[model samples]
Target: MKNAIEISHLTKSYGKNRGVIDVTLNIKEGDIFGFLGPNGAGKSTTIRSILGFLKFDSGNIKVLGMDSVKDHVNILKNVGYMPSEAWFYNSMKVAEAIKYAADVRGLDCGEEAEKLCKRLKLDTNKRIKELSLGNRKKVSIVCAMQHKPKLFIFDEPTSGLDPLIQKKFFELINEYVSDGATCLLSTHVLSEVNKYCKNAAIMREGRLALLDSPDIDDDTFLKFYYDEEDL
Candidate 1:
């Protein structure tokens, strides 16, 4: 299968602090690739680099056959991204924020957005700042999915969502994947990964500790990683 994302010899640092080191991975087109790691393990760093948000010390990153830095504008047009942090104009209502995102993405999916809002049980009239963390997350998901981009990149996507909502989110993801969309998901939620991801990369200390298909249960996967002290 053709690759949707490719990283080779990727390295990044924050002055003296290492963000990522010699990271390399390939995600096939139409694959749900899970990126798993403990805190500070460079998952977000790598994602940002791939999105051209942060400059790396050295490496190559390509998305959809285009260099990330040089082709960022074009790449972004075909990509849908949801960051780890959900940011919005504090005073804007949820519906307004979703509209703003849709406008920016050149999407006119008011009906789809409304359906998602109803399905997620999100109150569209509440100001962003007034919403709880989970509500904010729901808004982000709605915005990201409304555009229907070919590639979806989500960082810690389910952090503040309830279990029921999380399940709904996964179902939505599967729906997208079934339509031949690709995803690169970074999260600490092993259960979600086990359920949705076909392949996963486990990162530790800015490097890959393991990369494998989801052939084992989450508990066994956790035990395997725990047994490996350095990871």
Candidate 2:
């Protein structure tokens, strides 16, 4: 199968000694890939680089067979992204924000947007400033999934979500995957990795610490998880 994402010695620095270092990995098409890392471990840095939000110092990144930097606009056309923190025009209604996202992509969302909003229990008429943290996250989810893009990149997607909503969120993910989509879930939750991901990569201190399948025995995976933590 063709790779969905390819990072070759990807490096991004932030003066002094901060940022990702020599990261390389390949995520296959239609795979639910997990990116496990603690906060400040460069997971977001790598993701931002992939989305062309940050310029890397060296190395290369390819998404869906297109150069991340040179073809970022094209790549985005097929990718859905939910940031760890949701930020929208606080003065606008939730529906307006969702509409704006669809308008930018120039794709009619149709009933898909309404279906997601209903499942997530997000009130579209509510002003963005009135929603709670969880509700705001629900809005983000709808905006990200409404287009039903080929690839979905969710950074810490479950935070602020309740257990019930989280379950529904993953269900929606599975639903999308069955339609031949790919997902890259960036999170620190090991259980989520074990339950949802086929392959997983762990990051530490701005570098790749381990890359393995989560379907491995729990004992073996825990050993690797702790070993990396002790480093």
Candidate 3:
């Protein structure tokens, strides 16, 4: 088994503000890894660093056997990212937005986009500004999955989505993983972690609080969250 993502002694700070501190982790290819953390716990910070969107203070991050910074563009080509808050050109239609995402990867994703849109119940004819939060999330899902990238980095991906759509989304992810893709799922939904994740990590105060299987007991999590020393 190969590691799809590797981080060693990774640290990042936002001036005097807090960020991730000496975080280290590895996810094997084809694994569905869950990232759990309260708001402001640095889950997004660590993810941003992995995508080379933020400059870290020290340490190294490798994705797909390549340096995160030096191979940023190449890494992007194989990554399918769906942010919690998907941003789009308000003036463009949803179909156009998906096309723009496909263009960025230099791939023709028409067939996949259509399939995902149908499964997600997304309206391709709607303008970006006309869509609600859930609709926007659906658009993001289409954009991310259309190209069928090797790796998925989803940050709070299920937010704003209805129960049916959320179920469909996970089904699609399962299909992707079965095809040998890897995923990094960052979210606050513990139920999802328990159901879909093989391995999980929790963060607190910009530091790792626990690293274990997703089937963590409630008491154990409560103890760990109250104070890292308790764990």
Identify the runs in model 1 with alpha carbons over 4 angstroms from their true place.
217-231
TM-score, cand. 2:
0.94
RMSD of each: 2.1, 2.1, 1.7
Task: Report the Cα lDDT for candidate 3.
Answer: 0.92
> Candidate 3: TM-score?
0.96
- What are the per-residue Cα lDDT tens digits for candidate 1 across 59-165? 99999889999999889988888888888899899999999988887779799898899889999999999988888889999988887878999999999989999
Model 1 weakest 10-residue run by lDDT: 222-231
lDDT of 3 by residue, 1-231 (tens): 999999998999999998999998999999999999878989999999999989999999999999999999999999999998988999999999999999878899999999999999898999999999999999998988899989999999999999999999999999999999999999988889999988899988888855657998776556545655655
TM-score of each: 0.92, 0.94, 0.96
Candidate order by decreasing lDDT: 3, 2, 1
* Residue-by-residue lDDT tens digits, candidate 2, 33-75: 9898767879999999999999999999999999998999999
What order do candidates take by TM-score, descending? 3, 2, 1
